[model samples]
Every structure is written in structure tokens, then in C-alpha cells.
Target: MPLGRAGAPVDWLVVGLGNPGAEYVGTRHNVGFAVAGVLADRWSLPKPKSRYRGLVSEGRTGPGGPRVALLLPQTHMNDAGASVG
Candidate 1:
């Protein structure tokens, strides 16, 4: 459906820790990524992409016009420690 109206923009960025590999899709090491996936579903996130070194999705939600960016890292599982700060 088309958007009802454009309101004041509010943005959010969510980072999930994980390795970027089909092999690690549901492994224990991807717990954070799992959570992010669930959250993205909740907020109706757009398709994930590889731009910016990992999977990224973004969109707006809610009456307050909340914009959100959700990221699942591509770094190796062992070195998953960085985030947008």
C-alpha cells in the first residue's frame, strides 16, 4: 500500500554480530544475526544487500516515522567486534 503521509523522520541503526557465509546462516555464532533478522521482520525491513561490507536493510515504520537501518556483519565470526558508533 502507498504511504499515508510523510512525517518527521526518526532514524535507527541496528547492528548484528556474525560472519557472512551461507554456512553460518543458523549457527550459534549467528545469534545476534538471528535476533536482527527477527527485528527486521518486525519493522518490515527492505531487502539485504552487500554494499558497506555486509548485509544492510533500511526503511521507515510507525506513526512516528521511524527510519531504521539493520546490518548483519560479514567479518569472520571470531573477530565480530566492530559496530557503528
Candidate 2:
């Protein structure tokens, strides 16, 4: 994935804080996840994978030439990084 030229190579990992399950998927606290979804759509990205209590996505967010691999980690609000891998 290429999120446009970063001018410099950057390994970006965008984390969306939220709890597990469908119940908490759309609460106010999960706005990060919602925004991340918009970003994914705007960038023509695909759905993420689910595992370890979180949804993960890997893709770019920019035009041609060169881009960056943007990561969306939809982990719970607390201990979000616990399931990172």
C-alpha cells in the first residue's frame, strides 16, 4: 500500500480505540474507528481482519507514484496495544 509520498519513508500504524463486539462498534468512543473507515473508503482500501479482540487493516491512502502502508488497529479502548502483532 502506498499512501502517497511521505517525502520520507514512514511506517505508520493508525490505531482505532474501541471495544469488541457489534454493540460497541458505533458508540461515541469508537469515533476513531468510524473515521478510520472513512479514510479507508477515501483511499479505496479494503475491509480489515479480525483477531485478538481487534480489527486490522493494511493499505495506502494517496495517489500514484509512491505511498505508505497505513494500518488501522481497531482494538478496545483500554489495552488496545495488548493484541498488537
Candidate 3:
């Protein structure tokens, strides 16, 4: 389950699947993305940057908790595998 640099393995991969356009912003289909955003804010992670064909943010969950990698795929839901893979 690790997806981080060597010696700093990520303990979790939180993925948010949604379409990649403004038209889908607040729709139910984007709920996963919205949740991911809330988690990132709550975890105090830095703003996600474009990477792996998606938006990525990495940080620990509290001081000594597991390391997490949040991903909001920019691809359409049907094509999310491109980003996650």
C-alpha cells in the first residue's frame, strides 16, 4: 500500500473519482472529490499539485499517525484507471 519515497512509505491512498470539468463541480458524481478536499483540509495537507494525471496531496494524519496520499483523479470516472494506475 506504500506509494511514497523510499524509507517514507505512504500508509494510505485516498482516491476521489470524478469528471474533469467545471460543469460537474457540485454534482453528486463529484462527492468523492469533495470528500477528498475536506480530508486534505482537515489533515492540513498542502494544496494538491497536478501529478499522475490527477491532483495529489501527501501528508501524515496527525503527528504520529499513518502517512496518507490523497488523489483526485482529473480524468472522467470511466477513465479513472489512467490516473490511479
Instruction: Please name the candidate that would achieve the greatest lDDT relative to the true structure.
Output: 3
What local distance difference test score does each model get? 0.69, 0.59, 0.89
User: In model 2, which runs have C-alpha deviations exceeding 4 angstroms?
Assistant: 1-10, 51-53, 65-75
lDDT string, candidate 3, 1-85, tens digits: 6566465778899998888898999999999999998999899999888888999899998999899999999899999999999
Model 1, 1-85: lDDT tens digits are: 2211244333666788877778887899789899999888887877787745667777866545667777777777565454342
What stretches of model 3 exceed 4 Å from their correct place?
5-7
RMSD of 2: 5.4
Ranking by lDDT: 3, 1, 2
**What is the per-residue lDDT of model 2 for residues 17-73, given as tens digits with 9 covering 90 to 100?**
556668876798778777777777787766676644566555556655233344445
**Which residue pairs collide in model 1, if any?**
none
What TM-score does each of the candidates earn?
0.70, 0.63, 0.92
The clash numbers for all candidates, in the given order, read 0, 7, 0
